[model samples]
Target chain A: MNINRNNYEAYFISYIENELNNTQRKAVEDFVAMNPDLKNELELFGATKLEADEKIIFADKESLLQKNSTKIIAWKWNINVWASAAILLLLLGVGWWMMNQSAVKSHQFSEEKINVKSDSVKSSELRIRNSELIKTEKHYLAKNNFAKTKRVENKNFNAKIILPETIDTAELPNSWTSRKKWNEEHEIHVVQEIKPEEILQVQKNVAEIDTIKAVAQNAISVPPTKKTEEKMIAQIPFKTSKNERQILKMLAWASSKVLGKETNNGNFDVSIGFAEISHKQALQDN
Target chain B: MTINDYNFCVTAYADHLFRFIFKHTQHEENARDVVQNAFEILWKKRDEVEMEKAKSFLFSVAYKNKIDQFRKQSKVNLVDEFSAQTKIINEHKSGLKDALEKALNTLPDIQKSCVLLRDYEGYDYKEIGEILNLNESQVKVYIFRARQSLKNYLVSIETVL
Candidate 1:
């Protein structure tokens, strides 16, 4: 701790800074007092210790802090906003999916209801037609016994009516009915001498009946046999005398040519007959 | 560090950091720039810097920026130094404080920073070394040399007076 002349520079710095203990401080003071040359040097070194100027101050203190905090807040806010937007989009997607599912379900339900209604309407029509057909057959059976039933074949008629060999008719109808019904039952076999207009009308009525029955039955059911029967009946028009039938057949054939081309299944024979009549005058001119 | 701790650092150490940088840089705008940059760095790394070590961190950052500024202005400083010398020579005799300020400009940048940190801020040799990125012995030597130079400059001025 003794401050010698050789090591006095180190002690002088320490002593001026008040870093020395009491014993060392006293030793340095004693040494400086003894050496007049080192005293001025130590005083000059002390003058270098400058006080901080009050004018040298940071002016904009809060701006840096404010800018930093604002950036952090903005980053956090952006993350929150994006998360909320994503959640909202997900909710909208789920809602849209649910709505689409309900729409499909309602559409199927309505289709099923329409099918049910159509089936009921078709069944009622079939019942009424079947009853009428049975009554007509019974009346014909009674009349077949009273009259001498003649079996005549017409090649033009495609439907072959195979009658029973003997009619065991316990019932008899002696009264006469309308000519239209009689004509319908026996025209193709016995009464082969009908007017051309009457024959054409009969063929037209037959086509219309077939069309109505086929449409009603085929609307919901797929009975292949009924469809074939409808087509055959529609194709075969009633026949008369050879010359008259030939003229009518020629006329029918000519009219049928004007019908649009037949379907692939040949199911449009009825349209051919009407097409033939409308073009008859043109045919005669030709 | 929390917000409150960061604010405390700003309030407590801003002026001290500014004075330290100003002494080294000698230009008010450069010193202010260094102080602001240091605070900005502190705020960005607040989570990593401890509340107690914030003052040390600010000083270290400011010291580094002051050196960078010096490097950028090195060419300009050479020209300015001549003008500054002429001004000092022609100026009227001021107090010891003005003489000390002129004397500080004569020291090298490292020596000036070391001496300023030691004398103005009262940082010990180890602390000064940490701020200046030097070893304790290097900081000690720089401060010693700076003080000797200041002493010589002051004595010559007094002789002229």
Candidate 2:
């Protein structure tokens, strides 16, 4: 555009604003020179252009700097999580089954370590007075006293007096002959009040029971202490079912046969009134 | 924009933003607040802003914040201007620099922001227009009127001297 009396001021602003080229700037200078009366106003206009203030800076740019390295993560859901859970559960189940299998194998290799601590008396007896058990087993399985042992196959049979080889419970009959079957038969809950030592002693002497009817019959001839026996019978615990009573009595008599000293003395009161069933009587008689 | 781009805006434009806001607010804390507010808004909307527009966005926000601040405290502004002039008259023996500064303060806020953004940032008229939400011609007019006002202020001071 042309600089004129009317438009010269716009030219002047552009000139001072450094918006003008050299030709336009020179034209503005020439026009201003031609107008000396407007010179002071032009100088004031030039002076209005403010200088940059270098000193006023933002003091703490540090506060604006974010230190968190948080990534902008768009939420992505895993639809396969159920599959992963199922796989994890499968692994856990397999681990549990393996552990259970190993536990059974270890069970078969194990047996109770029988302790044979004797009571004050040399001949220790463990008998149950549960007459009900006696009647049932005596009628049915009692004839097998000679076979009083489906468990004769157990290594514990030939075991010596002290610290015998453990009898493998697996070899025992499926009947309540094994202690495990004893436990499994939930029908009975006989808490043995006898020192477990007395039971262990009976267990020890049980090995001496000769599977001969001749020796067993001789034991029956050893005169019975009917008076002492009656007193001991009063001490018996609850009357058991026939099978459990028969088992307890058989164990007691096997122990008695080996402790011949106490029996010969006739001092064997067997006062604790436990049992000696037809199984052992049959074994001793055999 | 990325975080690095945002931080670059901070390093590059913080001083200019501060100086521009400071000229209008005339108080360091108030200017810093305006400047900080601008940067905070920029950071919050970082994803929406472009790197090329960061400086313009910051100055635009700062200018609006300063105007808002002024509007909020407008009741006291006249009293402040009167006191400023009184202080200027009392300190009349100071140089043209002080006179020019006082005179700059005397101009309306729009002229002050326009002229200062022009000088301090060396922004072209379109750039200033973009920051102030004015057209290029409006920016030019505001700058011209601001210069005329400043020149008149200088003339008054010269006659007094």
Candidate 3:
């Protein structure tokens, strides 16, 4: 009954495992068979071992078993849906910008045509107003000529020339008095017929006024006044027939002070006159 | 090995490996997943695995898979439901079974696994060593210590009673 510690340990484990050599296995079997204490110990060990194993083996069925692949597939679907939503949002944003740009372009396109039409209508109105003013001027000139011819025919010219009893013409300038006396002595007769000489005179005046008015309109969009233009023109380098070198020397000196060292012969500054407020102001400045 | 060889491995070892993992993990679902993943990995690498060594291969795969699962789940520190489970089983136990279970849960994980492989599965020292990734001597020591711990705990409970 007394087994050594080492042998007992070996036998204890081997006996429990049922892995002893034939003879050794039989010996331990016989010993446990005869010894009740050893048998009881074996039984307790066996029971404890089995209970522990059973508890471990008693796993929850749901936790151990793999669930269906549906949950994982659903996660994949979530990523796909979000990606599609982002793409859709980007497309919508681009489409909205394109639509707004198109609308603005179309609005500007229509506005340009309306502006062009309004400009043409304004020019036509100006032409009509000019013609009306010309017609009124012609009517006033014809009536004055008719009245003057009637006075000459009725011998009433002297009666029309009746002077004031007192003369205090000192206040009037000599230029104004001379102009008035000339007008009284000679009638300015405008012939109703289309005379070639009269047409030539009118054409010369028209050419001057027309060119000046065109220049004035062009310079109205610019900054300075007509006096500046005349001053600039008077300062242009011109040589008389007498001494070209002297004129040139004078011009060079003047230009150095005025036009600086811009001595290039081909370079010329053309000055165009532009009017400002009134005829009286124009004469006063001259 | 072809997929057929892989499938054969699955049919042969899946249930056994699942049962083995179930015993250790004590959760049927975790056991199933561990086995399935082990087989899946084996299937993926069928070309590399020898058909003859399929059992050891599956067990090793299952072992690694189970360990990884245990470690991952441990991160959240799932409340040790084992204590509550022992409490419930304790109420139903008429005798030493209650004391034995409480003592078993108290043992360290390796020692408990070592004892379970030896006693319940009827594995020898070498077999337990292979299952637990321990040497025979280490397995022996673990089992002895585990049994001594259980015995001490049970005796202590008796003294208290």
Candidate 4:
């Protein structure tokens, strides 16, 4: 369209709306440049268009959706927090249980050590008693002249007896001759002189023997023949007879005397044998 | 699009659609309902809607719902008329911007919608035509008439001031 004064308003409005074609836009621009008075009107129209746009703003969606959006966020946050707390609690429980188990194990270990030490001490005392009993048995065999006589009477008797070779018999004091004389004179006296403590020690030895028998029975894979059991019993010459009882009492008294001297001021001199007469008297008392 | 893409669309275009509807309806509740309904429709057809076309789809749905709202009311909304009257009464006290707003209210609903789509959203005439269910030329005519009304209001205000 031609941009004359009458048509300029339509072209200027179209130009402001960006509706004018290039030729129409040029025509409008030329007319506006020539008439500077129309420029202020165009500026006012542009400002009004901008202001009208500013007036019709949409409500902020972030503010509008704040309640729902925050709720969703809080729900997710709560799940995360709870999950973390649960894992932490589980770890703490596992740690506490492991610590308690270790403490119990250590306590048990210490108790085992104390029991082992006491067992070793008991075993040592039993060794000393065993050595004394073997010595007493040898003396009874010699005095009664049974070692040679029993071999002929019991044809199944084995001459070889298995003794712990660890104990040196030569280290024992030569009080066996006087012990025989004391026995001949006071065989009954020895049984009467046996102390209660010695009797308790004998009972402990009996219990230990029973335990060993039980362990052996559990360890054996096969049952022994009746003949083998009989042979095993016949090999041991020590029977539960009156003479064997007297022998046990005499051995107990001798062990007590030896242990008493050793315990007193810790003196363990084995050669003195106290006095041969006092030994004879102890045998008489036995 | 996936549900994720639909959710993205809601966050991205919800405010823009709401603004367009709110400007057309001049009622906050109606605009919110229209935007929400538009999103619901988008979600229902999410499998068919593409991510790039989501903005156009949302605006189209919101615009249709806004038109339906205007049809449902049938009677002219006195709120807009009252606001325009108050704006004109206070025209001398306000700037050319206030006068232009009053003039915008004076235009036909279709013209006002087309002009706003053109000026405010910076949509081309063809795009505005698509949104308002008009041809490109028709969109151009609505915008030109709307701007002419605005310019006249500004001049009258300036002469009064």
**Which is the leading candidate under TM-score?**
1
After superposition, candidate 3 runs with Cα above 4 Å error: A5-10, A29-36, A51-286, B27-29, B68-102, B119-124, B150-161
Residues A1-286, candidate 2, lDDT per residue (tens digit)? 5777887777777888999889988888888899887777778778888886666577788878765454322222233566678888999888656544443442342222222311100111222222221222211111111111111322222100110123222322222223233322211233223344554444343432454223333333332243423333233223455343334434434334443313333322121111222223323434
Q: Looking at candidate 3, what is the lDDT of residue B67?
A: 56
How good is chain A of candidate 1, measured by TM-score?
Answer: 0.30
Give one digit per residue, the lDDT tens place, for model 1 in B1-161: 98788888888888899778766665556666788888889988999999978998999988776667565563354323323222223235377778998898888888888877877788998998898899999987887777778888989988988
* Residue lDDT tens for model 4, B41-156: 88778788889877878877777766665644534463544343122222242565566667776777888788767666688888877776789989877777777777777788
Q: Which residue pairs show backbone clashes in model 3? A: A63-B29, A63-B30, A64-B28, A64-B29, A64-B30, A65-B29
Q: Judged by lDDT relative to the true structure, which candidate is superior, 3 or 4?
A: 4
Give the proportion of true interface contacts each model preserves, from 0 to 1: 0.57, 0.62, 0.07, 0.26
Indicate whether candidate 1 or candidate 3 has the larger DockQ. Answer: 1
Candidate 3 CAPRI level: incorrect
**Residue by residue across A106-216, what tens digits does model 4's lDDT show?**
334433543453221100011112222222221112111122112122212112111111212232222433333333332212343445555456535433434323332
TM-score of chain B of each: 0.84, 0.83, 0.65, 0.81
Top-scoring candidate (DockQ): 2
lDDT of 2 by residue, B89-151 (tens): 223436667778888888888888899988888889999999899999999999988887888
lDDT of 2: 0.55
lDDT (C-alpha, whole model) for all candidates: 0.55, 0.55, 0.44, 0.51
Ranking by TM-score: 1, 2, 4, 3
The estimated TM-scores of all candidates read: 0.51, 0.48, 0.38, 0.43
Listed in order, the DockQ scores are 0.24, 0.25, 0.07, 0.13
